[model samples]
Target chain A: MARVDRSLVTHLPLFAGVKPDDLEEILREARSARYPKNSAIFEQGADAQSFFLLLHGHVRAAKTTPTGEQIVVRYVAPGETFGLATAIGLAHYPATATAVDDSIVLIWPTAAWPRLAERFPSLAANTLQTVGARLQESHTRILEMSTQQVEQRVAHALLRLAKQSGKKLDQGIEIDFPISRQDIAQMTGTTLHTVSRILSGWESQGLVESGRQRIILREPHRIVVLAERSADSGAA
Target chain B: MARVDRSLVTHLPLFAGVKPDDLEEILREARSARYPKNSAIFEQGADAQSFFLLLHGHVRAAKTTPTGEQIVVRYVAPGETFGLATAIGLAHYPATATAVDDSIVLIWPTAAWPRLAERFPSLAANTLQTVGARLQESHTRILEMSTQQVEQRVAHALLRLAKQSGKKLDQGIEIDFPISRQDIAQMTGTTLHTVSRILSGWESQGLVESGRQRIILREPHRIVVLAERSADSGAA
Candidate 1:
């Protein structure tokens, strides 16, 4: 049995229209689970039996190639819902999700989705909106990958991360999580060596600072300029 | 008053569960409209007032860049839906849709969608499934464009078109539409020169037959082999 956390109800976007009492009712159907750093929650092609709501920490969603190259599609933060395959009527998970750090999540049975959607039209509407936004974002990324250069892609991605999960620090905006150069390379479709070289160049120019495991954007405006240039040239 | 086309209802996947009489009731609100080739049915950034079902001919959904470069994202055929922004609860179309050829389409007012979803939960489910499939396809395309070679991408696109609209002829499986080298180039994210050169190479090898505006797949097996090379290299 999952402990009823009132604050969790307020965080999930799917529960926006759900009254406090109704949320409690829905939460009763969900169980809370915790994962340690680098733990695999689900693997690709596995039966998608449940959906999840992140309560604390971050999760990385990734796809692997036959050659074992991993591409990090996106990271899910606390207050977001994932494993939407059930809502979209998929039988299997399309990608693997792993905990980036110690994380707590609420899991709901797949069977409960339709019943909830029927009882609360707003839930369906919100799910549709979420899917729509994700589709749009994916489309934009496709357009960028098809047309933009790698350096520009890196700059844009950094900006997006800053917008989504940046924390203001004394020197600059720090990405909320520890991300490696390899992770950046995977996200931007570039080599890790290239990402390292670019970051070193930026660091020398006072555009960014590299910590042991994190990156701080010291000059966002300069990175924006680089992104714009890459967007125009269609080269990275 | 809109003329209710009973036969047309059978073509739509959403109407599969609906009785013939129920389909008639649904079609009663539909109005048929004709659009000339190259005519804009709906423009990006315009208020989305209605959704359309293609009854005859084809339409191209495209986005225009700031510099006026147009990129066609999708081509809709008979029995497919367009202007789906309404289904996603969006107020504006994100891309412009134009008639690729003179087309006849059945129009449904945006106001009707909510009532339809309420009255037919199956309809909503079916529509959502279609959207989900499309989103998955888009993601697949993004992955391909990001990682696959241009030749493999073009081959994949051709195979997809053949699957969707091929007509078996005495010579081979003929793509049942007039498509130009430039169009293929755009679809495959390559230059017209590159597409033309590759097609010429394939033509010389008797792999395909290319005429003024038609493409005949003389050896789909060979093309499939080429496409598989990329797929085997680790794209799913």
Candidate 2:
């Protein structure tokens, strides 16, 4: 197990009220594990055994259907927690957590939860806040997917990703992580062919530029308008 | 304020292990309020100042787009909590909470959360569990919306609602509340015209019987099969 920086624990919302000694104790029992790009940190239906705190890199949370279809639920940023199936009493994970890039995570056995929550009440409180916000966001996305057209849904997905992990570039802003059309298709709940067609249309308009899974958003404002334009669409 | 049965507090997942004095204090401060049929209990973008526990009747949580189109997020049931905007630090409510029928709720100011959590850690833990489950369900719905066909999505929505609040009758299982085709359309992210067309087809097939805000599943198993079937459809 690799030791974590003491300062890192002090800054995390989940550890807001955790004392120095308790934090040290937790770090002592925790394991810092690394994963290569495109590998799964945890797979759906696997044993839900641990909770992870991302130390570095991005991960995509996805769920798959019986028909072998997939959808990206959300992406994880550094300092965020993931793989929390046990928090809701699930015996197995309901989704897969795959590393988008080479990543590091601090792992703790599920057994640590009860002691930790009782010792630091803020831990449970912070967890409630995080889960509540994610629930709200998921609900918002459902409404968006239900009411918005494919074009609007794709634009909104890219915009959300850009806001979370965008990097400034000369062309405009890049998504920062290596993601493909298939990944975008999964995120927006459309086929890769459709995403390709939409991206091609946007490329001709100088709105975006893409090559080999790397994309740069040349114009975000126009995309925002496209995301909100709903009159002619047959969506609810 | 209308007083609640003490047994109700004793059985709630959120109140487990709370001391009798603390439970009594919380109940004493809580107000049981009634909402008339079709009236909004809380509207979107309003102040996020209160938390509610549904005591009786149903509610529809929905969000609207800038174009004035709306979609239902989820239906709230009795013995559940809603109006949790402040639970995640949002200053304004992100969605509207309207009574589907006349309803009653136990209302508590948001200020009570911290004190309640401090006195009863289980309160926060239970909140975490509730939020976590809702988050998981929302993620599942997003995946279904992204990867499933309109028929499949609609089927799944009704099945979920029925499972949550269905009442058995001689002909079939009736959804235990009033809900419209427009509401189902909103939940599934389709137009009412499409919903009507599909429901008409199903009615002919004896799969469902719906009219005037009432619906009974004549053949739930067939709908489940339809929901789980995925090929040859415009979905992920």
Candidate 3:
């Protein structure tokens, strides 16, 4: 582990009000770890000993069903936190976090969480906002999955991924990392065949382009309209 | 509007760490508000002026689509909180909170949230758990909605409602409050027609009995199996 850049802590909105000395003291017990692409950072049901501050790259936090199917709960982007069982006051990791690419994250022991939170009230305050926003987003997605058709769900998922992990490209907007049809399916709660078919239709309409593992959205606005599709619009 | 029973705040795990003086000071600005059956405590898109602690009775926190269709996001039971836009750092209520039955709640100005939070950091820490748990539940629902059939979804919704507000009756576990089939439809993201058809089928099987805005689950275990159904199992 290299000497961790402490700026990562101070710069975060969660710690913006934190003093330099306080952040340095907090970072003293923290260490940085890296995981290669497609590697598990932590497995589900393991003792949740720590929480993380993502410094580089991407990761997916997922849960597995009894029958061995995995559901992607969220995508961890840079500067965000992941593996939050401790922050949420849980004893074990409820989901597995896997790196989507080679990634780095600052690790803090679960024991330190309370002390840090008590010492810096904003830690808890800002974390509440983060967790609250996630809850809101999750609720919205559930509504979409339940009310909206497959095409709308897929469109909404892609647009969100683009917002979080998308990189602007000359052609349009590109989802910054390698994501498979299976990954999209897992994220949207659809089958790979269904996702593949949807993507194929989008491609023919010049809405998106896909390669082996990359997807580029040519007109994200159109995708938004697609996502906002009303129940009656489909019948029309 | 009456002086809040301070014990309600202290007894809660969310405020376990706060001093009595602090709790009283925080509650000084709080008041109790009541809503009649089916009346809204707060409406979606309205300025988020306050959040609440459910004291008695049942409530439904829902969001309405642009087309005036409502989606039930949560059923607010006693001891839980709702209309938490301020806790999430939002300016307006993202959803509407309405009394499912005649209900009472302790309401506090959203503006006071940050001040009290800084005074008692546990407010944020405890809220993280609440919001995180919600996020986890929403993720599970998204997965279910994506993968499960409509029958499965309806079964799941019933089982959940039973868990939240069920009352033991001579016949079976009666949903304590009056919830219309349309409410079930919104919760499950199905249509009233579909819900009606399924409930009728269950009635014939003696698994459930429905009477306008009321339902009893005679066989909850079978409903659990229905909720756990797999794609292949149905075909088989």
Candidate 4:
């Protein structure tokens, strides 16, 4: 067991309304661990015996098809929870999570969830809210994929990334992590070639800058305009 | 206020592990209401002041595109809850829900959710589990849409519907509700013409029976076969 940090409880969304003493009691059962970039935190279909809270770095949640195609579902940032399927009674992890960078995370055993939930009703409520929010975001992504063109989807994805983890650079707001064109393609439900072409076009038009595994938004509003533009224009 | 049913609490998945007395106490704050077929129970983006539990008949949860195309997201059956978005702190409904047939539902004010959740930890945990399950399903659908061909998508959609609310008929397993070809189109991300043609082909092969507004699966395994078949066959 790791020493419980009173401030860490305040940082986690699930423990928002819980008192520091209550969180300390809960965290007595938790341990802090670190993983290097590209390390598999957990594998798909593995028994979900634990849940995690990221304290630093990024993680990617993904699923793999039988044909070996990988689809990136979500990216977890610091202060967010992962392995939530366990909280919901799932026996196995639905997707594989890999550390995107050197990451520090707080780990909680599955056995502790029910006890903590019983003790602090607010924790349970907050967990439900977190799941609900994620579901809504997933639904929005589904609607976009079903209706929006590829370029539009890419633009929207970039905006979402900006909102979550953007860092202002000399030129514009840059997504503060390493992300390849292929990663964007997977997230946007498009082919890598399509993502590359559209990004190159945007780069030429001064809408964004793309380089070795990074994207910087030169004009965020312009990207929004492109995303909201009618598909009839054939720009997609 | 209608007399609340003590038995109703047992039927709700959210109240699965709750004590009978506690459940009855929660139910005292609920009201039973009925809606005629095709009546809107709630609209997307409406103030989500309450949550509902279906007791009889069926409800369809759907979202409409700005272009006026309606997509059926899911169907709520007896004992299932809708409008849970509000319970999880959403300010408005993310999707509209309507009665597919004359339906009876239990309505609980949003304010009651936190109270009930606090008093019965099981209810909160179950709600979170439901949200998690939906998120997994949505992710699976996204994977299907991105990688699977149209025919596979259709087959998968049918399987999902059957799992949710299929009824055994002389012909096969009927979907247990009315759904237009257009609804199938929206669910499968295809056109009505394409859905019609595919169903017609399936009907000819005795894989399914299609009526004016219902689909009966004659051989569900065949649908599974279609869903699993390689896209290289060009059956789509």
Candidate 5:
């Protein structure tokens, strides 16, 4: 693998506060790879041999239940880290990571982790902060699933996606990636038919615009109101 | 406050691999406090001024929804860490932590994290691993909520609690903590009535023994079979 330029990653939060020399050493140990759209980056239960940083495009992390059902755990955006099973003491990947779009990522063998973390204390600190943020996000979703209504849960999911990867447009903020109603269903713990019905209802109310593999929040404020509204009949 | 003895925490996972002198220094920065059972350790959205380690007793971390419903996030067992809001970059506690039993905790102000983490690299690595493990657990729960039946979810929750804090008895493993049906309801994202009905059915079938504020799994193998049973009419 060719050496990556320091300029490519000095701006990343993972590299923040790391000296240029340390960053050079870290970058040298990484090899870059690309996945075509919809290609699997890694599979659940496979040996987690490497950690990754998405340098370009988006990735989806989905967990397959024991019963053969898949749940959309979360999405990974550019400059975010994933496939950190070894860092968390797990020997196998807990979820399968797939490229939602043609994507590039920097890969480092898990064997290099201890050395890298020891040499660059900031790296561990940064990763800790990142993991912390994601834990909070997961907790937020759990709360939404447990206490909020289905429509509210869907609204929250869209809002979170928009916040994470939205592209501001005239209509509002487009999700900026190809996402289907099935993805939203798995995200919010609802069935696809129920998500479709809720989206259709929102479309009629001018709250959102949905199309094949696309979603745009036309009235984000209104959606927020719905998301925060008190429980109706409860989870769908 | 009197200084806590070093021996009190030498066996904790958080202190693993930390040198004795370093442990002493870390202990010097912490003050111990006791929380009476059923008392609030910290409220949601309060300034996250400190991080904590449970020295003795259990703590329940619950998130209260906007509509006033409380969801039990998880239970904290002795020797576990909690209140790490600042470590994750949060300015306030995300959930309210309450002592389920009279508890003693070692507290350290958030201001000490950076210096301590930098000086003791193991601290950062340990915390990263801790948060990573929790992030995986949260994802597991999310998967259960999205894909599993209510009975399965409850079974998983019980199994988890038992693993975390169970004591062996003549009949079966008893969850060592005082967990009520309502707590189980909050943990499994089901109504109290639903949890009660399921437990009653299990009791008659010799799967578990339930009582006020206590439960025992008399037939864990059968419950595991139920938990792994595929899609019972899809997520009650």
Candidate 6:
């Protein structure tokens, strides 16, 4: 069992409002581990033996469709929880979680949930809050895909990524991760060619800078305007 | 403070493990109300003062995008819960919910959430399960939209509705509600014209029976095949 420092998770949302002693007890049930970059922590349809809280680095959660095409579900940031299939009543993980960078996570066996939840009610409450927020985000993504144009959806996807993990730089806000155009295409539900063309057009218009797997938003406000452009104005 | 029968909620997924007396006590904190057909139960962005469980009727939850286009988020069936902004930590409702039929719902003020959640941990657990299931469904929808053709998407949408509220009959399984093509179009992220043309083709093929505000799947198995058709085979 890896030793966990109380300070490592004192500021995280999952531990919000928890008493110090209870926090220690909760941490006792969790085992911490490291995952290398690009390693899958869990795969879709695998038995969900444990749930995790990311203590460091980023993770990508993705789903493979019946036709074998991959869809980027969402990216998990530090301090967020993932692999919660058991909490949601699923026997297996619905999507795969891969470490986007060398990451540390605190894993708790699913069996401990009932006892822990019984002893510390806040655990259930916090998990509910986390799941609720994700549910709302999923609804928003569905709405965007249903109503918005491809470019608008792509813009929204980038903005969401920037908000989640962007770093302020001298030039502009960088997405703070090595993300390829193919990843953007998967996230936006478009083809690689279409995503490349759209990013190229944005580059010429001075809205963004992109190369290889790096992206920097030169004019995020402009991207927002483009994302919110009305259907009439957005029509080709 | 309208009367709420305990049996009306005992079988619900939200109250699955709640004890009978505890259920009664929970019901005591709630009020029941009726919403007329096509009435707005709650509007999007409204102050979310209450959460509810439908006792008898269907509700449509929708989100209006920034550009003023409405996207059908999901439909709430009888015995299901909705309007839980507080549990998710939102001060305002994210979407508008409207009655599709004469409906009765047990209403609980948002202020009671913490108390109820503390008193009954199953409530929180069940709600987490509900939200998680919806999130999974949303991911499935995203995958479909990202990879499938419009026809396949439409097929999947209809099949989903049929599974949710289908009424088996001699001819076929009816959708059991007044859902128009425009609603289906909005649900599947396509234009009305495209939805109409596709449905017409399906009608001609004897795969479905669709009229003004009704749809019946004459050949559900065939529709499933179409919905699962690989992209290479579904291309026009």
For candidate 3, write residues B1-236 as lDDT tens digits. 57888766578866777778877887887889888998989889999999999988899888877767778898878889888899888999999888989988888899888888787777777777888888877877776776677898899889988998899888889998888899888888888999999999889888998889999999888888877877568432
Error of 2 at B224 (Å): 2.3
Best lDDT goes to which candidate? 5
lDDT of 6 by residue, A194-226 (tens): 999999999998999999889999999999989
C-alpha lDDT of residue B89 in model 6: 88
Docking model 5 quality class: high
Distance from true location, Cα of B134 in model 4, Å: 0.8
- Model 1, A137-194: lDDT tens digits are 7766766665677888899888888887788999989988878898888787777888
The C-alpha TM-scores of every prediction are 0.92, 0.94, 0.94, 0.96, 0.95, 0.97
lDDT of 1 by residue, B1-236 (tens): 86756776586786767777767777888899999887999999899999999988778787765556555677788888889898787899988998877899999999998888767666676677777777777767766675678888888888888887788988889877677887777676677889899899889888899988689999999899877585455422
Which one wins by TM-score: 2 or 5?
Answer: 5
DockQ of 1: 0.50
**TM-score of model number 3, chain B:** 0.92
Q: State in Å the error of residue A117, model 5.
A: 1.3
What DockQ score does model 3 reach against the true complex?
0.69
The lDDT of model 6 is: 0.89
State how far residue B85 of model 1 sits from its true place (Å): 1.4
Worst 10 contiguous positions by lDDT, candidate 1 chain A: A227-236
Global lDDT scores for all candidate models: 0.81, 0.85, 0.85, 0.87, 0.90, 0.89
The CAPRI quality class of candidate 6 comes to high
Q: What is model 6's DockQ versus the real complex?
A: 0.82
Fnat of model 6, as a fraction: 0.87
Question: Where is model 1 chain B poorest over a 10-residue stretch in terms of lDDT?
Answer: B227-236
Best of the two (3, 6) by DockQ: 6
